[model samples]
Target: MMKRYYQDEEDIGLFQRMQQDDSQAFEEIYYRYFLKLSNTAFKRLQDRAATEEIIQEFFVNLWLKRHRLPELKNPESYLQTLLRNSVIDWFRSQTRQDGFAAERMAQPDYQIANATEQQILYADLQRAYESTVGQLPDKCRQVYTLHQRGYSVNDIAEQLQIAPKTVESHLLKAHTTLRHLLKDYSAVTITLASLLMG
Candidate 1:
């Protein structure tokens, strides 16, 4: 929930590296946020085991979708949002969403209305994100995915056993394609693109 001034540059750099599949960056992100994410989950579910599972799952999923991740504006907020969604899914799976919805509805009208709108917007954005990413060519998509997850150019080169130039070429094409694909989401194009692609 907090961003340190001194670590801001480092965090951004770390994410950039993670986008390229950097284990060090991935480990740092996990270590740095695991406890915070766990606490946030525990607060929502009040179940220690469930909270741990949710947080761990989120980190793993993030790695799986790293190629699709964008430059995160707020890493903590990003993880919180992921955890919130996970908790909601957990509640639904457990057949508790009805009660949870009722409790949420009992909140002040202003809060409920705002949250509702935000939820709808986020859902739409997520769909659009998937749609756009699904359009990339296979190799470009793979490169984009690997790089966004924190694989540096050289890392991707070594991992893919390709030349660094090839990795950069794929990255360039992926960026260009993504820009053209998401041009219509002018309002959130930049922010969403960053979030969806590192």
Candidate 2:
């Protein structure tokens, strides 16, 4: 997955205040990204209780390490990377505790783990695509959806009673918007292609 720098001036200012032991700044940061981070964690872990625990631990650690936050360029990216690593560590710990040493040590099980990871990544990409598409203008969304569903531009224009050039314009607008919105999900292009083909 491509790392995203979601930090804007507000995020940076919050982190700076948090580094100074400001409780309100810490709370704001927590509320801002908590749901998003939790959703990402739950998608991978697939266990509500474990996901909550992991997320709580992540926040605790973030608080503990606030003094060093100034060194980081993108705090949101750091949170995402740390959460992903934490989930992987949780899986490994589960494997060890479950006495699956043979499977863990052997090479064959690696394929299963890799496949699961790929599925999780695909799920993330799909969510990003859907979310971004949902944000498009109404006409652009209709045009884009029909186009992706294999409708000819002329067909869409006919169905919507618009000129073909208008259809093309909406499509172009959708592409530009999606490209900007989904830049963080670089693999979404592959997902969209496969989805359209399928």
Candidate 3:
């Protein structure tokens, strides 16, 4: 029988090279891992378009942070864990948002009245934050939004099939870029600016 190479061994070597900032190695890693990770995520999400988007975002992030990848005992296992967690998290967030909306809808007229200018300003700030986030490179924006929505760096990395260090790097770069872009604004504005500009 011809010797069959274990997938994990190939992954480890590619990951190590990616950590060294080798683009060729990272490309090899992406081709090798993207479909597998996407299929795994899709099994849980059951939304092919969303799952594919998520997987593409993940790989883009991996490329962006290839230099700081951490050593992994088993890349496939780690990715599987990430997909499971992300699916759970996505559902939880949907549940929370639904509950919040329901609660708002159930309020009495007196209790549900709209706010004044201050409240409007706050809302505007929130919108501005979202806008800033929209301005980020697609992958960076996705990572930032995921982080804000409570995904951990590890989870984000796994969902994206990249390294934890790469996640941090995207966040850091996003923050720095946002800070520079919104430095002149007030604290609230700055906060909004960073996220939107990210």
Best by TM-score: 2
User: Judged by lDDT relative to the true structure, which candidate is superior, 1 or 3?
Assistant: 1
For model 1, how does the per-residue alpha-carbon lDDT over 112-180 read when each residue is reduced to its tens digit?
A: 685676556545645665676788788778887897675667888898888987877786676556546
* TM-score of model number 1: 0.44
Using alpha carbons, what is the TM-score of model 3? 0.42
Each candidate: what lDDT?
Answer: 0.64, 0.69, 0.60
Candidate with more favorable, higher lDDT: 1 or 2: 2
What TM-score does model 2 achieve against the real structure? 0.47
Better of 1 and 3 by TM-score: 1
Worst 10 residues of 2 by lDDT: 1-10
The RMSD (Cα, Å) of candidate 2 is 14.5
For candidate 2, write residues 64-103 as lDDT tens digits: 7889764667777777898999999999887766447556
RMSD values for the candidates in order, in angstroms, are 13.3, 14.5, 16.5
| Predicted model with the maximum lDDT | 2
Please identify model 1 stretches exceeding 4 Å from their true place. 1-9, 96-198
Clashes of 1: 23
RMSD of 1: 13.3
